[model samples]
Target: MLNAKSEIQKDTFEPASDNLSERSSILTEMFRKALFRNRVQLVGGILFAIGTPLIFRFGFDQLPINSSALSNTIVGSIFALTCGFFFFRRLIDYPGTEGIAYAIPIFAVTYGATVIVFLFLRLDYSRYLLGASYFLTVVWFTCISIGMVRLRTLRIGIVPGGSANALLSLPSVKWREIREVSEPTENLNAVVVDLDHSFPTEWERFITETAVSGTPVFDVKHLRETLTGRLEIEHLSENTLGSLNPDHMYLRGKQAIDRVLALLVIVLLAPFFAIIILAIQLDSPGPAIFRQKRMGYRGSIFTVYKFRTMRAEQVGSVDDRDRAITKAEDDRITRLGHFLRRTRIDELPQVLNILRGEMSWIGPRPEAVPLSMWYEKELPFYRYRHIVHPGISGWAQVMQGHVASTDEVLEKLHYDFYYIKNFSPWLDILIVLKTIRTILTGFGAK
Candidate 1:
């Protein structure tokens, strides 16, 4: 019995030793990772400084044909490198619009760098669109890159109680510490954090030492603003978005172009539209022309029109219960209706909505007034969308798919707000381009 006990004790002791060593190594690696993340902005600048722009312009123009072996290898390697970099770095957080928002600058920088180099290296660079594009691209890229780096490192992540929620989203000490508060009933900007994991001795020392000497710590909104290049509204709270004013929101003149383009579209597509109406009428017993009262432009209601895609009895008319949500493969859809809806030909009459003062070409998709009534009460800043005229196509429509429920509407509302805040001509161009692309892709069609 004594011999057996001695052997067991030895075994236990060996594992404990191994556990300590393993922990030490893990801790060392975490420290290195944290430091490396903190230094990304500095490193990005250095990498950018080496004139990546010039290299791209030369290489891109001369890039061999797609069928060439060298072309295939280089393209494969480049794409692989980008994917590896993003995936390994966890550069993308949430997918969909969130992912797109984060990635925009990365592309801008990649192309922009080539432009900058061309301008600096070539005397004739001023005559080309490349240099100008580079200049434009860099502004967006640098701002967003700094914002992301700041977000990752908590550099500009926090404002006076305004740091982004992403820091808490990260798998870090702060993430472990923040728990959902049930009792207080008040949203918090900052909270005392605790962790079962031991704090790094170096980090503990660094925070205690340097944090006291007037270096700023972040609030969530600060980081979001930095990352998004737009001031973010605060969390859902009693005073949440109290300062938010609908009048403060603006979309640029290019949106007017969206309106004009929409008009032109109606004219150009008029014959096809006539045929669609004929088809809808022939396919279903219901009227081809359907008009509904939709809320638009600061709570005013207007008659919106569409080609009826549902059977006369199966679908609700404008005056019917006003339950606007439609499901995928809904039984209501007629055979021809399905095809029309999928291709968005049913929405052609919205060009009339644009012509009429009720809508823009690209803004928020108008909802039924009764539904807006419920949403305005349920979702904070929901009415903010009404600040601008409703549009036939919108940022949310292009960036995300249809909203089937209240949850989806609220989510789409965030994208709408983001668009409202960053209403520039460039954004409008992108939205229009994307709208055309969507019409081609049919990704979100019924």
Candidate 2:
């Protein structure tokens, strides 16, 4: 049997060794760098947006308009583009309208800001100029939106593997025309292959020739993880897990920053906290704060705190604790509890946990002890999440939402593993921003 352990190099899935191919082609290596494509597209889009003002200026200068109108036009465009950049930067990875979902909010905010600006400045421009500005802006964004959707819909080839089924089921990737491996073809964006799986001599030769000719090659496992944003547990082994060493220096720095920020948040939100406390007291008989034991860094257990969102229930044994999964329309949830849970204000109490060094501002969410124990027993490499301190909001929390069953929890752990494997401050910031959408939509709240 071909060894299923042959690993692909990080990021650049360049061939690990010469066994797969005789020699790598210069064009293939260049094409394998997909970041270059994204960068060029992004830079092109930004230049077009920045130049939009100039386009309007040229046209408006011919019309009977005051200089202030031109200045206001430039200012409004800058404001809109600035907001658009922030949203686009995050949404660019997603496919279809989902990639541009942030644009709707940015557009609304920009429209409001422009209305206020025009009102405040009292700048009266020709109706034609005003109408032209709005029209051009819409046209610019609409064309770019179409371009991005088409770019993401490129045909891709997949050499089937264990994760192929999962990738096939994801909606975001449904836009991609996925095909089985055949003779080398020039019309494909990228090819996903199982590096450890064997192929016929002719098939292997075709892949080598295609890869060397500037066709980007991707490992099936890595591509699936990138596309779905989840780490498949079945693909991981001891060597891979062992390679994820926690950077002590980085952790120390992150922890120090987390504590300071948590303290500041608590102080600022004290009034809101008091209001929530009062609401909880009036809504239920349980203590305002519910303390539960959760597994933390390096397998350490810590008491995590959250505002009580459910009725106080008696737990008589371990079996009862094991069955404590929250369900939709659960009778134990109070009216106020439902609101608090949906809004995630119930987690505000965890700021204290962060201050106490039991958690960070962002990391994997700490699973309750009973749930953690059950997961450890049922899931592979579940204990790996404890490598870092738990967090109030995490990759899993934002991406997968609240998991209620063993199957869902297994899916969540995939995201948790991805976060652990690729932890960075920028990623945490992105998650924090995305969490706002969740709070607003009350997505996945039980």
* C-alpha RMSD of each candidate structure in angstroms: 14.0, 9.4
> Which candidate has the top score in lDDT?
2
Off by over 4 Å in 2: 1-87, 94-97, 103-147, 160-184, 235-239, 246-250, 313-319
Candidate 2: residue pairs that collide: 28-214
Quick one: best TM-score, which candidate? 2
Question: Measured by TM-score, how close is model 1 to the native structure?
Answer: 0.53
In the range 202-282, model 2's lDDT, one tens digit per residue, is 657767877898767777777766666776666567767664666677789999999999999989999999999999999
Across residues 1-446, which tens digit of lDDT does each residue of candidate 1 receive? 11111111111111123446877867754543433342452344334422354345446466434434333333332333343334323333211222233334444455445445445655333223333333433443345444433333111111111233345553312222322222221122222212222445753453344335433333344333323333345354554344333333244454466578778897898898888878888887878887778889878999898888888776674444344667777887889987776677778888888776678877778987667777888887788778777876777887776776777877788778766654544455456556766777775766
Please give the lDDT score at residue 333 for candidate 1. 83
For candidate 1, the lDDT comes to 0.53
Q: lDDT of all the models against the reference?
A: 0.53, 0.67
Q: Would you estimate the TM-scores of all the predictions? A: 0.53, 0.73
Query: By TM-score, how accurate is candidate 2?
Result: 0.73
